[model samples]
Every structure is written in C-alpha cells, then in structure tokens.
Target: MKKLVVMGGGIGGVASAYELKQAVGSDHEIILVSDNPWFEFTPSNPWVAVNWRKPDAIRVDLDEAMSRRGIRFIHDPVVRVRPADDQLDLSSGTVLDYDMLVIATGPRLAFDEIEGLGPEGFTSSVCKTDHAAATAQVVEKLCEAPGPVVIGAAQGASCYGPAYEYAFILETELRRRKVRDRVPMTFVTPEPYIGHFGLDGVGDTKGLMESELRERHIKWLTNHRIDRVESGVMHVTGVKPDGSDAESSTLEFAHSMILPAFTGIDAVMGIDGLSNPRGFIPVDEFQRNPTYANVYAVGVCVAIPPVGKTPLPVGVPKTGFMIESMVTAAVGNIALALAGEEPRHRATWNALCLADFGDRGVAFLAVPQIPPRNTNWSSSGKWVHLAKVAIEKYYLHKVRKGTTEPFYEKFGMKLMGAGKLRGQA
Candidate 1:
C-alpha cells in the first residue's frame, strides 16, 4: 500500500486527510501527525474569546475522527523534515517514513519581531484558543474599567478577517453591555485602506468597511507601521504617499489586540527547493510542490504573492472555501497517481466571506479568487449572520462525525448553480 503522511491537524490538515481517505478508499495507508490530538475550529475562535461560544463547542478529537475513516493518527510534533529521504523526525525522538507527504502545517506567529509585543506586554491575540481565553479574561477586566480599546493587524499580517471580526465583535459587545460611550475604540491596521483585506479590495469591500467603521464611531489609522507597543500606548509611523515616513503618532489604550504577521512553520522553512525565501512552500496551480512531486500544500502555508501593491502590506486571502478546494484537488490527484492512473486537475477556488457587524453582517463573493474581471459580487444583510451560524454548526457536526465529504464544494456549486463534481471511478 502507498504510505501517505500528513503534517498538522488543523482544519486544512484534517480536511486533507479525510479527502485522501475518500479518494484512495482503503487501498492506501494514511498517517496524520500533530502536536495536539484535538482540532480547533479556528473560524469560531473570535466568538469563543467573547463568551459567545464555548471552547468545547469548537474542538474535536482528531484521533477518533480519523481512525473511523481508516486513517492512522499520531499526536506528535514534527521537529524536522528530511524531504530527500522521505523521513520526518518527531519531537519524541521517533522517525517516520512516507511515500507521499502533504504539508498542511499552518502559519507561525512572529510576535518577537515587534518590540514589547505579545502575551507578556500590553496587547493580546485571538488567533489561538489559549490566546482567546486569556484575552477574554483581560476583556472582562477592561469592561469593568471601561476605557480605550485598540484593535487591528500588525505589519505583514495576511489573515485580516479575524482582526476585523474581533474589532466589530468587541464593538457589538460594548453596545450590548451599554458601555459603548465609556470606551473610545480605534482600529489600526497596516492595510493601506480600510478594507484592502489583503486581496486588494474585493467588490466594494473598501467602501463598505470604511462606511461601517465610521457609522460605528470606530476611528481608524491606515498605512501605519507599528514600531513598538508599550504600556497602554502604541507607537506608529505612517507611510507617506511616496512610501516615505510621513508622521509618527502615539495612541493610548486601556486594552488592545493586534494580529501578528505569519511566517512559514519552522520545519518547512529550512527545507530547500520546497519553500520560498519567505518560508512559504511553492506549489503548482494544482497545489503540488514543484520540487517534490509527491509533496502537496494547502491553506496559508502555500506561497501566493500579493494581488497588488499598496502603501501598506497586502497579501492573498485564503478563505476556508479556497483551502477546501485546494485540498480536494490535491487528494484527487494523489489518489489517481496511487491507482496507476493519469492524474488530472479540475478544481477552481473562489472567495466567500461573511463579515459580522455587531447586530448584522456583510457577505462578499469573488468567483475565481483572482482579480481583474469574472463574477465579483457582495451584499449585506442579517441573513449573512444566519448563514454563518449555519456553516459553523454544519462544520462542527462534520468534524465530530469524521466525514470526508467537501461541504464547501457542495455549497459553492449550489451558489453558482453548477453541476456536481465528477466522482473518481
């Protein structure tokens, strides 16, 4: 049997493993390795931090889930990857070999790059479950004090959705508690504009987000680079239109949350020919690593360049649906190769974002993910909130049930009024 090893047990990794099992059936041996056995539903993390959702409601037992689908699970962190030898050194002093390797390891937070940042100091993050819990406690204390709040993403940060979500959620929470007047909220981001969102303003997102921020009385600072975060104060230097230093400003806050930039995971960073200088793996249009034919990557770990240049940082946004599409394509190709059949690539990814706005929500759709034409659309409504809730519940159920079917694929097709995917023979 062909042996397949998948690293990381997050959403991307788990989804890939499940899809691999479905594609190859019981013919191949699949092993998933991760430091943690439990998979956290990352998208719901914002809610978890604010007491809207519980921790247990978003976590799942990966071992049980994968075992039921005939995939082996190892709760161990990968220390090093000897890609040339097809072996991996685990932190527990064990080495494992694989015929094929799938790198779904997510991005690593680079908090140390900034001065006086991270958990030890003034700001907090909602990127992880632990961070969220910690931030929740801090937020509770801040609620009692009722002071200034600052929220936004740091330099080179690609995942801007969470930052925006946290900002709006906090705004909504303050309104709910009737403390909106007591707290002065500010949104600071490295994005050149209000809603660049790393993908270069998707379908009026720029206008819509700016309008919403203004309506909510949320002050924003754009094209700003944070030099250091001190006690209750953030020092920022805004970039001029010509990309030069414009002016320096210092903003004080009682509580702050800033999303740090992400780099490639440590293991994959040291591998030659497998990753870029930025440590992101380079994959073909089909999501297969060019240098290592048997290696595939998905999610934020894959190196995709920015859509356009902005005064501030701009990056490609990898939504959940996009990640799912990549995983599906990779799994199908690998399964075909294992079955001694010619591999074919036939999957396209699009962006679907549902931004929650305190009492309501806004939705955006970008067919074919890339810009410069195609069907691009966006809308705002309360139903967007309902749809988000439904998606969360559906995903949680699937994770608990250990199913491999691509829910996003079905949902995307339904939205586009397209036909079903062609099943493998």
Candidate 2:
C-alpha cells in the first residue's frame, strides 16, 4: 500500500485528510503534519478575540483526534519540501517519503513585508489561536480606556473578511462594554472600494458593506496602501484610480488590527516549477501541480490570479466553501489514483461566505467566486449571525469526528443545487 502525506492542520488540510481517509479507506496509510498539535476553527477567530468564544473550546488536539481515526500525526514544522525526491524534511530531523503530497500549509503571515506590523508590532491579528488570545487582551484594555481604532487589510493581502469582521465584532464588543461612543473606528483597505472581498464585489456586496459601515458610524478609506506602522500610528499611501499617487496620510489609533500580506510557507517556497514567485503553489483545474502530478494543493497556499487590475494589489479569496470543493475534488482524484486509473476531478472554486456582524451578519453565494456568476446572492440579518454560530459548532463537531461530508449536509446542498464541483455530471 502507498502512503499519503497531508501538510498543515487548518480547515483546508484537516478536511482534505479526513475526506481522503473516508474515500481511500484501508487502501493507503495517511499522515498529517502541522506546526501545531491543535486544529483551530479559524472562522471563529474574530469571536475568540472579543472573548465571545474561548480558545481551548475552539481548538482540537490533532494528535488525539487523528489518532482515533488511525492517522499518524506529526506536530513538527516542515523544514523544506524537496519535491525532486518525493521527500519531506521536518524540523525534527526526519525525512518522510510519500506517494502523494497535499500542501495546505495556509498563508504565512507576511508581517515582515511591512515594518512594525502584526502582533509583535503596532497592530493586532486574528490569524491564529494565540494571536486571537493576545488580541483579546488588547480588547479588554481598550474597553477600560476607549479611543480611536483602526482596522483593515494591507496591500497585497487577500483575506478581507476577517478584517471586516474584526471591525464590526470589536465595535459590537465595545458597545457591550458601554464605550462605543468614545471609540472612533476607521477601516483601511487596499480594495478600490469596500466589500470587494478580493473577488470584485459579489452580488451588491459593495453597496451592502458600504451601507453597513455607514450605519455603524465607521469611516473608511479605499485604495489605501500601508507604508509602515509605528507605535499608535500608521503611515499609509493613498492610491488613485489610475494607479497614480493620490495622497499620503498618517492615521493615529489607540488600538489597531491591520491584516498583513500573505506568502507561502518557507518549506514550500523557492521550489521551481512547483510554486509561483509569491510562494503559492500553482495547480491545474484538478488541483494537481503540473510539475509533480502526485502533488496537490488547496486553500490559501494555492495560487490564483487577481480578479482585475487595481491601483493597489488585490488577490482572490479562497473561502471555506470553495476550499471544501477543492478538497472533495482532490479526494476523488486520489481515490482514482489508488485504483491505477487516471485522475478526473476538478474543483468548482465557488464562494459561499458568511460575514457575522456580532448580533447581525451578511451572507453571500457566488457560484464561481468571480463576478457574473450564475448564482450570485446576498442577504443580511440577525439570523446570519445565528447561522455563523451554528456552522462554527457543526464544523468543530465534524473535525472531532474526522468526518468531512456528512450525509445530511450533502443532501441539503443537493436540494439547493449548490456545492457541486464544476465538472460534476
């Protein structure tokens, strides 16, 4: 029997491994490697930062959990991936060979790209459990002493949902603490406008998000490039529509959480033919790296081109629903490979997102993620917030059970005629 190694333990990686186990069954041995022993529910990170959800409650121990499913778990950081020899080097000084590899080590926070950014710098983050916990501390101090707040994404950054979520969630928390009036919040983003969400305004998202921000009494600046962040201040360069310099400004903040750019992990970077210059692995429609047929990728580590040209750099988003579709396609292809047949599965890469606004939220569905979708819809209400909580709990339950596709969820998706891959027949 051959062996399959899946890297990273986030939603994309864990879900892929679980689905692979269910698909291949006893045909192959599966191993999962990650830098952390726990799997984080990244969607709930915004809630965690505001103490709405506790860290331990959202974290699942990969060692105990994967072991229950008969999958080996390695909690060491990857030193390097020598795709040339089908070998993986780990920080623990061990090498492993795999018949197939799925690189899902999500985006490495490119904090160093900008001086004095990220957790160790001027602003805060919700990228990881520890980061959320640290930001929670910042939130508490901010509650005691309210002041101006700045939150948004940096140029070249792809994930914008979390930044928007942090802004609204933090606003909700401060109001709960009876300090909303004193704290002035401003959103800073590289997108030409609000609600671009890296996919070029899906289904009136631009209008909806802009209205939401206005209703919340939050100010916004678009086409903004973060030059640098220095203690309680951020230097940003505003770019015009024609990609020319609009102006430069320095914004002051009592508390801030600026999302930084993302890059591929060091282990997967600088590998010719395997990844793009930005360190993201380039995969075909089937999610397989062209150079290494046995290698596949999903989630933030996968390379996708920008939607269109913009004054500031803006990349596409790999939402959870889209990543699940990729994971499903990968599972089908791997199953085909185990049978010595050619792989034939391609991911649809659609976008179904839920943006919770503390007590209320917004939800959108873009069948193809890009604009002009056959299915493009958006709605908002308190029920969306409830749905977000429900999804968080459901996802955690499935993770603990090592189940990727429950029959009920799949049936529901089918009834709605959604969540199927592009080439599904």
Candidate 3:
C-alpha cells in the first residue's frame, strides 16, 4: 500500500485526508501528523473570546475522528520536512517516509516580528482557543475598568474577518452590559479601507462596513502603519488619502487585540524548493507544488501575492470556500494518479465570507478571488446570523462524523449557481 502523509491536523489537513481517502480507496495508507490531537473550528474563536461559545464546542478529537475513517493519526510536531528524500522528522526523533505529501500545516503567527506584541504583552488575541480564553479573562477585567479598546489586524494580515467580528462582538457586548459610554473603541487595520479584506475591496463591502462602523459609533484608522505598540499606546503613520499626516497618532487603549501577520509554518518552510521566501508554498492552479508533482499545498499555507500595498501590511485572503476548492482539486488529481491515469485539473475557487456584525452579518462572494473580476456578489442581513449558526453546527457534525462532502456543495450551494454545478457534474 502507498503511504500518504498529511502534515497538520487543522481544518484543511483533516478535510484533505478525508478527500484523499475517498479518492484513493482503502488500499492506500493515510497518516495525519500534527502538534495537537484536537481540531479547533477557527471561525468560532471570536465568539469563544466573548463567552458566547465554550472551548469544547469548537474543538474535536482528531485521533478518534480520523481513526474511524481509516486514517492514522500521529500527535507530534514536525521538526523538519525533507521533501527530496520524502522523509519527515518529528520532534520525537522519529522519521516517517511518504509516497505523497500534503502540506496543510496552516500559517505561523509571527508575533515576535513586532516587539512587545502577543500574549506576553499589553493585548490579547482570539486566534486560538487558549489565547481566546486568556483574552476573555482580560476582557472581563477591562469591563469593570473600561476605558479605550483597540481591535484590528496588524501588517501583512490576511484573515481580516475575525478581527472585524471580534471588534463588533466587543461593541455589542459593551452595549449589552450598559457600558458602551465608558469604553472608547477604535479599529486599526492594515487594509487601505475599512473593508478591503485583502481583495482590494469586495462588492459594497467598503461602503457597507464603513456605514456599519459609523452606526456603531466605532472610530477607525485606515491606511495607517503601526510603528510599535508599547504600554497602552499604538504608534501609527501614513496618510488618509487627502495627503495628511496619519503618523504619530498614538491611540491609548486599556485593552487591545491586534491580529498579527501570518507566515508559512516552520516545518513546511524548512523544506527547500518547496516554499517561497515568505515561507508560503507556491502551488500550481491545481494546488500541487510546482516543483514537486507529488507534493501539494492548500489554504493559508499556499503563497498568494498581495493585491496591492497599503500603509500597513496587506495579504491575500483565503476563505473557507477557497480552501475547500483547492482541497477538492488536490484530491481529484491524487485520485487520478493513484488510478494510473492522467490527472485532470478542473477546479476553480472563489471567496465567500460572512462577516458577523454583532446582531447582524454581511455576506460577500467573489469569483476568481483577485479583484477587478466578474460574478462578484454581496448581501447583508440579520438572517445571516441564523445561517452562520446553522452552518457552524453542520460543520461540527460533519467533522465529528468524518464526512467528505464538498464544503461548497453543503454551505455554498446557492452561490455556486448552475454553471459551476454543470461543470463539476
């Protein structure tokens, strides 16, 4: 039996393993290696920080889930990836060889890039379950001594949805606690506009998000570069499009949560000719590593060039739907290879985001991913909240049951339209 090794047990990695199993059948051996034994649903992390959801609600046992699906699970961190020799060195001093490899290790949070940032410092983040728990404690304390609150993403940050979600959630929570007046909240982002979201700007997202922030009485600083964050102040620089100095605008906050930029995971980055300088793996349109046919990458681990530069750092966005498409294509190609037939590349991915606005939510769908594109659609409503909840539960169920249903087929069925369905069929 051929050995297929999947690095990382996150959403992308587990999804890929399930798809690989379906594509290659029971004859092939599949192994999933990761630092943690549980998979956390990242989208629910923002809610967890605000005490809306428990940690157990978003986390799942990876060993049990994968085991039922006939996939081997190894709970250990990978130290190095020798792509050329098809060997992976684990931190436990064990080496595993593979006939094929899938790098879905996800992004590494480079909090050290900014001095005095991260959990050790002035602010807290909701990016991880533990971090969110810590942030919850800090937020509870801040509620009593409410002053100024700053929430946003740092330079080169791509996943902007969570930042926006957290900010709005905090705003809503403050209002519910009848302490909205005591807290002065501000949003600081690397995006050129309030809703650029790393795709230049989605349909009506700029206007809609700006209006929402205004209605919520939330102030914002866009196109601003954060020089450093120390104590309770964040130093910023840049212009507000009218050519005015946005620099030296120090905003003091009692509590803050800034989403730092993301880079490729260390293990995947350590592989020579397998990753870009930024540590992101460069994959072909088929999601296969360009240099290594048997090697594939998906999700945040794949390298995508920036749409443009802002005063702060900017990065390309990779939503759940886009990652799903890449995983599907990778599985299709791998299946063909296993069947001794030529692999065909036919999957095209798009971005679909549902941004929660405390009480309501805004939904945006973009085709081709890059800006200046076609078939771009967007809408907003309170019903999105219900939809978001339903989907979250659906996802949890699917993960626990180890279902390999295409994510788009389940969540994005309406957005896919007849053209995509006919083509895939």
Which candidate number would show the highest TM-score if scored against the true structure?
Answer: 2
Ranked by TM-score, the better of candidates 1 and 2 is 2
| Candidate 1 residue pairs in clash (backbone atoms < 3 Å) | none
**How much does each candidate deviate from the true structure in C-alpha RMSD?**
3.6, 3.0, 3.0
Give the lDDT ranking, best first. 2, 3, 1
lDDT of 3 by residue, 238-328 (tens): 6666545665678898989999899987887756679988799998877888888889887889898888656555898888888888888
Poorly placed runs, candidate 2 (over 4 Å): 406-425
Candidate 1, residue 205: Cα displacement in angstroms equals 0.8
Please list the C-alpha lDDT of all candidates, in the order they appear.
Answer: 0.83, 0.88, 0.83
Per-residue lDDT tens digits for candidate 1, residues 1-425, read 88899998987899888888777758889899998878998888888778888788888998888888888999999988888898999999999999998999888888887997777777998888878888888888888899999899888888887888888888899888888899999999889888888877777888888888898899999998889999999999999766788999999999999988888888888778898877898998778889988888988898988887777766777888888888888888898778777668745777777787656777776777778647566666677678778888999888778787778766665655632212200
Clashing pairs in 2: none
Residue 2 alpha-carbon offset, candidate 3, angstroms: 0.5
Which 10 residues in a row give candidate 2 its minimum summed lDDT?
A: 416-425
Query: Which candidate, 1 or 3, would have the higher TM-score against the true structure?
Result: 1
User: Residue 144: error of model 3 in Å?
Assistant: 1.8
